[model samples]
Target: MSAGDLPDPAEMTDQLLDEDTVRQVLTEGTLEISGRLTDASNLTLLAVSSLDGVELECVYKPIRGERPLWDFPDGTLAHREVAARRIAEYAQWDCVPLTIMRGGPYGNGMVQRWIEQPDDSPDLVDLVPAKKIPRGWLPIMRAVDTGGADVAVVHADEDKLKLLAGFDVVVNNADRKGSHILTTAAGGVLGVDHGLCFHTDDKLRTVLWGWAGESLPDSVVEGLARLATGMAGDLRLEMDEYLTVTEIDTLARRIDYLQMSPLYPMPPRGRSAIPWPPL
Candidate 1:
């Protein structure tokens, strides 16, 4: 199926298109670059793929367009993005959208199905007046806005975001800014921009620290158990396609630690625990 055959994201209650269909359309369909996301750190293009009279809107991040990073090796960000989705899927979480590594007009890159949020959707994470913290919202920290007004960085205490936070821990996501969380009209929550994940070291910076030091819910513990079990099977082999052997081993260890501890991790000591521009 091509992009044209997919239902409009807003009109769908669940996933607009199934993962397998998206994979086929993105891999085999013809791609046309329609626009660019200028705010992204890397070269991110907005594009459409067409195949068999179907069309789907997707984000294209070509490997050649990836910017050099001091910590990450050059040209591997797109691979990491695809790997993140695989890891999340393995953990039995659908928080990451369908992503595939494919050749595009810009050569080899990562292509992910675009998630459309409704216009009236509330921010899953945001900076709000310190005193006006919404009931049930969890405050992560306090800071000043551009006008020097007191503002608190906060996120919802919802299960969808909690699951994503757990997935971030397993992948060692180095950047989990508030804006990375996408809430759909269908009530599905997903995360994007995962090129900075799956690092070999402990770099789990994120805005979802409200659960820090709390015992992980049974659901999260179960997901960790699933991941721990997969480390010895095809999961490791699948991850090896995108991450180095060392990184894969480290990921396994992270899963083991979480299963043993079963608690949300505390912010790392002696390093920033939150990404810059937290929102």
Candidate 2:
């Protein structure tokens, strides 16, 4: 049903929306007539809100509306999006954003709460003027900017990025481009666009190789351990909703490996380690 066709449930606008409220608005809200996010690739991106009264801004990517991909099974990318968020939540790495797979104006797809972008926040993938990397940042790639001068694309080595880096490892994210990391208005970082993930094989392409082989700080290890237990136990059952049995088993193995080893993994030698257009 079109979102405009439904009734608004509450008079919520710019109010802090809890998970339940967000989910309800997404599941039952009316879609804006021109809600589609045109710049989105590989699928339609719809902006929607609950008809009941809450004006929640949300991005909806419907499963059936996806463009075909040779590598992934049809209509399954939306589930993987949800699965990535689940893993992120389990590890306490809230960077993945709150996501729900529910019926929308088009069909069943993934709905994520829109994060407000703050003008003052630093860009995750930004160019620097100097040759030397900054104290708390790492250079991922380099190139010239529009001014025909030297510039380097870098990421800050903050806890927010670190949490996302760890989360990406367990999910085997294949498209961790700089564009995928978003900065919230509150100066926090969050990772998005996780459809290309959770393959049984090792497909961890990303721009986050700055800390490869470094020890995952103790806090990171604790978070990983907590997730490992859940992945092996009840989480495995939930994983079935989005992942194949082989993929779930491999995720469990990754969790175990991360907990025991307690180090960032080395990039495998035989493959391209980072994504194209690193910024």
Candidate 3:
């Protein structure tokens, strides 16, 4: 029988999907099935029709795991859902379109807007040839080229840095790998993978180095301060139903850090060194 025909977790085991379809989507430790979900968990995948009339992909986490690498606890699926909603609400920006959908192979997974791009794209990590940069300061150079400095350097867009900072705060993201960032032909940069976010830790990690140990722009600093000061009220009114108090508090702390010290310390090299995780 196909895996799709199998019974859901809460149902009898005899109702499981047929083996053939499960194998079809399973390759190299990844599964690619397409169907209307009947139930979902953190590891489950759901396919839904998009506003554009095309089916899209989404992941659902009904339970958390143990000792999660990021701040999130294991088996904390509800927390992830709340965090996603909180980010979408706090940012007041549609950077991520988090939707609730039903009728999938697994069940109901939070359907996030999908970004289309080539499998191999130039990522910020590529800017550094070796694990350690020779000059220990190439990001500033790239930023300058992308208009991160006096002018837009990479994509000739000055506002990119600001948006990046905003995303970091909204998600309380601990890791911001180059792969997590998607660049569009229109010069837009998008961020993804917020599962490891909204934790009360100083876990900000990223590939951008231009602003490290440097004074932050007044505009960005001010924006962080504004968010920090109004987080409690804003979050309560906007995301209270979805997010927990702890999650909101963690987001507030991240904003506070940005406001208090815009320029964070650089990561130390050597034995304690590890490449940023692909978030």
Candidate 4:
């Protein structure tokens, strides 16, 4: 199913999407995969209609419905999705959309609460005249046309987007494409499609390099510290259930490194740091 099949988000909603209610629905809800979203990877991206005690819209990815990846093991992407959200939640970065793994029409899979981003929100990256940038927006880079006219690529300096930058680092997210950043009428930024994350190796490919060398905010550092300190407790246990022991250890190591530095790390030399077709 395409985005056109979902409810419009331009209109505001005062009624919160209750997490507890959503959890119940995602866990026990009846699923309807009426069609497939075509612009996805080898897997079928399903627009699902969920019904437990109430009706809701969601996206479902059944494990048995995916194509194999050489680097990633089969049937583990669902766990990675939930694990990524868990790590983000633990850090109090609510950038990730609410997600859970559950049994579905095909088999156990990942189901994410669909984020109805308001269409009016500005693109995460947009061209702006160099001197006309609004206050609180960050200038990404300057580009000059063949005719020598200059423009700046700018991003909204929203706290949620900054938090998501750090969140991607901690999760080692490998596929944070521009299309994954969802914005709400209330200016909430929710990240989705987190199936390639938390691998043992460094694989942080993302479009969120706007704050590449900036200092981490005090609150963001505090959150990473909390995650680092809790590695021996419930965090380790929860991750162990899905990720390999090596990957879990690597996550703790990454958190430790984040806590040790105040500045966001620079991209490695000779490495392709940003994801392709960056917005």
lDDT of 3 by residue, 38-149 (tens): 4321354433332211223444333322234444565444455545545554545434434332233344333444445655544443443223454423433222224343
lDDT, each prediction: 0.88, 0.78, 0.47, 0.76
The residue pairs found clashing in candidate 1 are: 2-54, 2-55, 3-54, 3-55, 3-56, 4-54, 4-55, 5-55
Rank candidates, lDDT, best first.
Answer: 1, 2, 4, 3
lDDT of 1: 0.88
Cα lDDT of model 2 by residue, 1-279, tens digit = 344543344533443555665666666667663467676765667575755566777778888778888777778888999999998887777688788888766778888878777667677666687587687888866777788878877788887788788888878998899888988766668898899898878999888888888988766787888887897688889999998888888888888888889877777789987887676
31-96 in candidate 4: lDDT tens per residue?
877667788774655655454235566788888877778878887888898898888888887788
Identify the candidate with maximal lDDT.
1
The 10 consecutive residues of candidate 3 with the worst lDDT sum are 22-31
* TM-score comparison, 1 vs 2, better candidate: 1
Q: Which segments of candidate 3 are over 4 A away from where they belong? A: 1-46, 50-71, 81-85, 92-104, 118-122, 127-162, 241-243, 268-279
* TM match of model 3 to true structure: 0.58
TM-score for each model: 0.93, 0.88, 0.58, 0.84
In model 4, pairs of residues that clash are 1-35, 1-36
User: Predictions ranked by TM-score, top down?
Assistant: 1, 2, 4, 3
Pick the winner on lDDT between candidates 1 and 2. 1
Give the best candidate by TM-score: 1
Angstrom error at residue 214, model 1: 0.7
